[model samples]
Target: MDKPKVAADSPAQVELEEGKKYAYCTCGLSETQPFCDGKHMSTDFRPHVFTAEKTETCYFCRCKQTGDAPRCDGSHKKLQEPERKG
Candidate 1:
């Protein structure tokens, strides 16, 4: 069986500012995964806005092909990030 193709972002592990609107990347081409990196300029990609009601961690979708918005949706489960252990 072939493995499912996932996007390029993990879940949001950090906290967000209260009452702040964030533009998430639906397209996986963004250099800034989970966020809009202006890579969608060429395509019809649009920035997703999610207002933070309070400061808390939230998962944004990095896979431009995800049906879910502002969530990982297990798209990046197989993908690994560069080792940046401190």
Candidate 2:
């Protein structure tokens, strides 16, 4: 499979409702950021289905490199920082 684009190097803070199903964008091509907007139909990627267990704020992975699917695991921190030459 092709590598997903880096939508952002961070997580997206979103409010989730209990028992609500969410389709997380795995293609990183969704204009909706961390959520799926049916934009992955053209790609080999599929949206991850996540059901909220409780009503609360959660962080969703936008970088698409999280160890946990659809969740932010701070894996974006491992991405190499650009070198700065003085």
Candidate 3:
């Protein structure tokens, strides 16, 4: 099993439909970004299957470091990257 890859350092804003089934990519390997495109099949990662509670714009976690799966808990804001000396 491989650790999840960071798709981005920010959350992805997406529009979700109420009662709609969605597949959120836990593995950042997906070229589809926040959504699953079956890229996790090569790894131990799997999509976070969920249904939309309400039709609204939502921020989805892309960093894959959120304690809350598929939700942006502002975890990306806490990622520590090496400071560039340039």
Instruction: Choose the strongest candidate by TM-score.
Output: 3
What TM-score would candidate 2 get against the native? 0.87
State the lDDT of candidate 1 residue by residue for 35-75, as single tens digits. Answer: 77787677666778788889877666554444577765674
Model 3's TM-score against the true structure? 0.89
Q: For residue 4, give model 3's deviation from the true position in Å.
A: 0.5
Give candidate 3's error at residue 36 in angstroms. 0.4
Q: What is candidate 3's lDDT per residue for 1-86, written digit by digit as tens?
A: 46788888888899999999999999888888799999899898889999999999988988888898888998887776841111
Candidate 2 lDDT by residue in tens digits, 1-86: 48887878888999999999999999888889899999888789999987899999989988888989888998888766641111
CA shift at 70, candidate 1, in angstroms?
0.7
Compute the lDDT of residue 73 as modeled in candidate 3: 96
Top-down lDDT ranking: 3, 2, 1
Clashing pairs in 1: 26-64
Which candidate, 2 or 3, would have the higher TM-score against the true structure? 3
State in Å the error of residue 51, model 1: 1.6
TM-score of each: 0.65, 0.87, 0.89
RMSD of 3: 3.3
